[model samples]
Target: MNLEWLKGIYVPILTPMKEDESVDFEKLRKQVNFIIDGGVHGILAHGSNSEFYMFEDDDYEEIFKVILEEVAGRVPVIMGIGAIRTSKCVKLAKLAERLGADAVAILQPMFLKPTDEELYYHFKTIADSVKELPTLLYNNPRIGYTLSSDLVERLARDVRNIVGIKDSSGDINQLLEFIRKTRDLKFKAFGGKDTLLYSSLNIGAVGGVCTTANIFPELVTSIYNTYVDGDLKESLELQFELNPVRMSMDKASFPVATKDMANINGMDVGKPIKPNHASPSGVVESMRKEMAKAGLLKG
Candidate 1:
């Protein structure tokens, strides 16, 4: 497959849920259009922000189907198959391929610290299971371990289908190393942190798998489009403007703030899944004020 089209802003879309925490297909479809129209180059259906671990295989297919249907070839879609078990990961990757996903992203297995060799087998097996869909390694250290650049290089060399990696380690040097090491291969490195989008591109990363794009895609896309358009000054200015809002998310619970911002902006994305309750009213109020100040919400 041609990996050239993979270069640009991609949103690890938030799964819209209802009061009971079930997938809201209606809202989900609308969101697919919301971001596409907002100028994102592509969409990630079951990304980390989508809460992939919370659903079953059948639920995964349903969510993937709705997103694919709504997207309808407007932009490439990558389905995230993030699971602790290799079997579940392969199963979801196959499901994504059957549903016509443009690619699959395997998030680092959580709760288990596998050795380098074991990690290689885990990712390679998933990539080998598919026929031709491009595969991306999601190196998120939040899972307790990181994919060393050496391991990433080995995968890129040995696996024909492993096309790229999303380095969410929040370490630019590590991301730079991945790019530097894989510079010759047909590999792409994407910045996984919202704060480092511009810098990532500056250092030769293809794009970013930014969570903030779930709320303000245009803001994030501008950073990519502007940079690509040869306006580094404007791109850096946009990135600076986005930093505060992205940083503020740390104040609220993980992932809740994305949904909260969507709802605050009247997207009505619904509450996060149960046990991961909505942000406190004060937190929500504070986020609202922050967004308004950022020009995301007009008071």
Candidate 2:
């Protein structure tokens, strides 16, 4: 498969929910248009930032359909499968293929730290199950174990459809090693952390699946656009401006800041799903001030 279309800023968009904690498809469609209009290059439905764990299989189908429909072929869509069971992951991967997604990103099985052999098989099984949809390995250490470069290389070499990885290890070196190790293969590397977008691209990542793009798509996409356009200084500067705000997410709870930023920006993405409430008012205000400092917020 020509994976050339895989390069650029991809948004792991927020799943806009209703006050009752159910997915509001209307808001989801609006969010899709919101990010695409903001200049993102691709869309990743069911990403970590999307609260994917809360939904059922039926939920996945509708979510995928809605996103693909809203996207309308404007940008490539990659459906993400982060389920823990190999069977479940395969089911979602097949679902993505059935829905006409351009690609599928499978997150390492969460909550269970499988051995290297088991891990390899887990990814291989899912990729093999799909006929031809490009599979991108998603390694988020927050799941408790990282996908070592060696493991990733082995999968890339052995699995015909495993074409890339989204390294959210937060360690730039880890991201670099994946790129370095896979350089000879058809594999593509994307930084999963928003703060490392410029550095990741500088070190040979094709692009990033940035959570911030859901809030500030133009800002995030500009980093990739400038870097690809040969403006290293501007791209680095843009990354610098994005880092503090992205880092400030730590002040709020996990994954809440992205939604907080969206709400404050007047996107009204609604509250995060239950058990994950809105960020404190002070936290949101502080985040707002940070965006203002970065010139992202005006009056």
Candidate 3:
């Protein structure tokens, strides 16, 4: 396990689909290579941006295999196995471990509220199943319930392999509490929200896993690298510059806008898996403006 896993920007690599809505392995390879070449510390294959919910079990496994092979140890590939079912999550963890993923990130399954103990058992079972690989607890209450700071601390204490947590809540207090609780315990914290990237770092998070990076890798990664390089002024500058892009996205379907960025870059990663609407064409111009302002416009 890479103890220092949360060191820099990680892009949740998009699942490229051809016109038929099938997995585009060829485009996925290009997407992975493009982001790597553009400069990212890691790649997350089946995160929220990857539309993990839409993919079937066999297809999910196949996608992970493609990502792992494409990455080829160039950087750590953190596989997202955060399923709603405990037994299935355990099974998924085994698959991730077997397929050569560096780590697994699990989220609470579905939209039901569970007690702290239930959440504990849920994470514990998954960790125990893949005891050899490191586990990251994902705290994004919007999808499922948030992992309370106490629960996180308890998990860090008991789950020996639980090395980190990604907080997407956008709550500074919760993030600060997480950092405080886990610092001495040798646990790391990362940002799961792009909007909180700067502040999350200010409060001692190592880095982040963000969707915006899938669109503008250089610009998104600069926020972390510039801060780490000791130029706080430039780092904040980059963050503020991204505000319009984030604002524009707030009014639209998120992953849809994200795929728009990829398309603008000359790669058609397709739209978000259905039930949700595809991004409005208007959002693309707003994103383009932001990208151009940050000097990220494609040639």
TM-score of each: 0.97, 0.98, 0.95
Question: Which is the winner by lDDT between candidate 2 and candidate 3?
Answer: 2
Where in model 2 is the C-alpha error above 4 Å?
none
On lDDT, the stronger of 1 and 3 is 1
Let me know the TM-score candidate 2 reaches against the reference structure: 0.98
Q: Which ten residues in a row have the lowest lDDT in candidate 2?
A: 290-299
lDDT score at residue 96, model 2, on the 0-100 scale: 88
Q: State the lDDT of candidate 3 residue by residue for 103-126, as single tens digits.
A: 888887777788998989999999
lDDT (CA) for every model shown?
0.90, 0.90, 0.84
Model 2, range 96-167, lDDT digits (tens) per residue?
A: 888899999999888897899999989999999995999999999989989989999999999999999999
Angstrom error of the Cα, residue 111, model 2: value is 1.2
For all candidates, the clash counts are: 0, 0, 2
- TM-score of model number 3: 0.95
Q: After superposing candidate 1 on the true structure, give the runs of residues whose Cα lies further than 4 Å from its correct spot.
A: none
Model 3: lDDT to the true structure: 0.84
